[model samples]
Target: MKNQFFAAALIGLTAAFGAHTANAQEPQRFETEAHAIEVTTFASGLESPWGLAFLPDGAMLVTERPGRVRLVSPDGTLSEPLEGAPQTESFGQGGMLDIALDPDFADNSRVFITYAHVEGDVAGTAVWRATLQRDGTPRLVDGTQIFRMNKLSGRAQHFGSRIVFAPDKTLWFTIGDRGQGERAQDATDHAGSVLRIDRDGNAPADNPFIGTPADDLIWSIGHRNPQGAAFNPWREELWTVAHGARGGDEINIPKAGLNYGWPVISYGRHYSGGKIGEGTEKPGMEQPIYYWDPSIAPSGMEFYTGDAFPQWQGNVFVGALKFQLLVRLTLDGDKIVSEERMLEDLGERIRAVKQGPDGHLYLLTDDPDGRVLKVSPAS
Candidate 1:
């Protein structure tokens, strides 16, 4: 009788625990779309490709993680790596990251980049804007260091480093927690937060914590190590893919002034199976729209709004570093109805997914000798 009573008690406790943690996880779905198209490799022998931006005149700009930016022509030819790219620490995960073109690139020739800098024991990330010359050289004429974080500690982890411009012309940038466990919720700290700023790198007056003592550039707080960010095609919402500790990679729809419930609530524990954050539920915290258990280590993301694949229009394409695959999420009006995995046989870690100006899909392979690949119908 005593044993039965103890078993009942344990079951009840487990049920209560699962109740709080259930919604925080997405069941693993392993279906991949059959490759109706052949995957063609464009250029190889390039260094670790982090990001790619296409130019209006048919050239391409690619950023290497080791602090070089190269111009590639439409025929997969590489131009000489640009000079005057910002010097990066190039430590373990610390180096150059995302690259983006100004929305008014035709008129302004303005380009932006994010990178990790090490100054003594302190290492943090910064964003800068420069101008591209007519002959495809990048001369950083107005190199402005826009935003930075505290508590870098030179740990060589979690730089975040993805930048995207919203429809409203505001630039949103992600900053990782820099391996600091408790700093995600620190209002005064820029670590683990997504910030919205004007083109001049100043915080907007309407920012949530603008007048407060906290960092004024903050848009949404509580991120782990976000590496993927893109604007949604349907709603134009800002969508991000963040890495979790052991499991629990998350896809978040970030909004201003919201607390994203990092460190406070996670479905994953530490790699050693210890506790993470406070608990799963706290009042007034925002929950993720979707998350992954047994994490895929999501990297770059793009919304499939192109006309090439009519069936995939409006779906979300995310790159996986750990799994070395491509993940596609089929959303039924913002609710993830199903998920699929692709490119398992390719043995390449996907770094970025982009829609070319020709409405075809382009991807960057994340490798020491990465390649630019194009996906089209096999026929």
Candidate 2:
């Protein structure tokens, strides 16, 4: 009998090797400047899988945007949607979003998730913490809503909400302007900012904006709509990829109390082919380490610090939704020196990119039949 749960995984991976019955495409390999890489479907039949995280044991946790979480065993058995996920609404880019395990998940059994919490017509970005129970039945319990945006909006767009744990153990999350451009410049508004808070949702004492007239959780202001965030352990700084209006997708290393010139300055034109924000450079705003013109609609980002491909170490990876490809950025210390676009023929809107513990690159596709793809070095 054909295995109903999963196909055979490669590289000793314990995660999905593509859904047994749903995947049929042959794996493909592409040559790059540093190394030849192979892309294979690790799992399929996922509905808009937005976020992916690997557990210590190599099992994977995946979140579907329409509001569900599931466990994918290495052998390809998929768990039922875990209960106790926060209630959310899905419309115009709002739904259950990123997922991250507690830094000490092995000891705490805690997990964090970001979603669009709905209240009437108002929907806001929210973070919910829960204890993941996998004994007998897989489910979430002891749920706690650790954080929610201070001001909810009726609009369903621009919920920038990728979460990462800083080296200091505090949580950092992104929020967009909720389609209100000027809102990003407001220090008091959570929208259009990078926020840092304790795991319990309290602002840390040393948060840069604490004594200022900004919200306690606000770390930096003037972001457009950041969808991808990762902490570069090598530099001990937070890096983010944010969507631009028409042509100005940006990659910024947001700093404490600094403004990132969104509505004030941008490299791309407005959707109407008009000028944007003082023509890209201003006196007080920070410039992006790099940016994309004619916007590729970048989403998830990963800093390659894995051992599988030693040459790829110190590189950066980003998934592009608009162009349906993966981007590898060659960085020289803090500066991005070159960019190579790959996997354009994969034919999926790559939503998120994750570096697994084993140092392989994994991705989530954005579609009704979304999938988890694993990228490894090609021999």
Candidate 3:
């Protein structure tokens, strides 16, 4: 009877994933140019793990897209789902997303999370902060809503939610156009912009658009669907990876009060091979630092400043969801020197990439049976 049940489950899985069965198997040996590395499965059986954050004690917190948070130990032990997580909408591309720990997490156990929030018939992206109590059964305490997208749409695509903290401890996050392309050009709308706010969700007094048509929280405008964000310590700028319609995947450094040129100017064309907006460049809008003619569907990104891989120092790493690989970009002062693709044989959607406290590279795969993987120098 057990064998029969197992056989039935296999059939169900095959039916569900028909053409994508290649992504369900164990990861294969990865190839790299700079150094020999080993990919170890740190933890397994996570359901579509979307975000990863490391605690000072070496433990990690992972967010599952279906509205669950799990604590993972250094020794590969997965704990029970934490309680007190905010309710998520969990629709098409919506659910529990990025997880980030406060810079002073050692003093305060505060953690921040982004998720799809729904109220009645309308839905949008929302961020929340809470204190994580790790005594026995891990749970959240004093959860507070920090920010919410100004425009709510009924559609369920393009919630570009990625969070990063600046040196001043101010929080920055991205929001997609919510599938409404024209709204990205509107400064007053929060649909497609990078927002900067204080820990208490207040706009800083130094904001460029304060008292103007643009919302005071907005730092940059004209974005599509940015999924990857990181603070480059070397350049001291906020970098982002955003998705385009058909081709035009871009890497941008969002600056205050600047327009990024979305629908009005795009390197990518429509999915139907039609023109997007104007041409790729205009007089006032900014061009991307680098763009991909064929989209890779980029996700989480991080700059490598750790000592584990000296050669990789100062390089930027990004995860590719559609291409199912990890991208290493060597940069010469923001000009991309070269690009290398790694872990192409992993056959899974690389949802997030992060550097562990131990200086190792960590990754979360997006799958029904997702996994947390650690990359180290192979002995």
Best by TM-score: 2
Backbone clashes in model 3, listed as residue pairs: none
Q: State the lDDT of candidate 3 residue by residue for 1-379, as single tens digits.
A: 1233223222112112111111233434555889888787888878788999998888899998877888887777777677888888456677899999998888899999999887765678899999999887788989989898887877677888899999989899999898999999999998889899988899999887998977999999899999999999988999999999898999999988999999899999999999999989999999999998899999999999999999999999999999999999999997898999998887879999999998999999988788888888876
In the range 259-325, model 1's lDDT, one tens digit per residue, is 8888888877889998887766688788888888888889999998877778888788899989998
Question: C-alpha displacement of 111 in model 2, angstroms?
Answer: 0.5
Error of 2 at 139 (Å): 0.7
Ranking by TM-score: 2, 3, 1
Instruction: Point out the higher-scoring one by TM-score: 1 or 2.
Output: 2
Q: What is the alpha-carbon RMSD of candidate 1 to the true structure?
A: 13.1
How much does candidate 2 score in TM-score?
0.93
Alpha-carbon lDDT, every model: 0.78, 0.86, 0.86
Residue 131 shift from truth in candidate 3, angstroms:
0.2
Candidate 1 residue spans exceeding 4 A from truth: 1-35, 136-140
**In model 2, which range of ten residues has the least summed lDDT?**
4-13
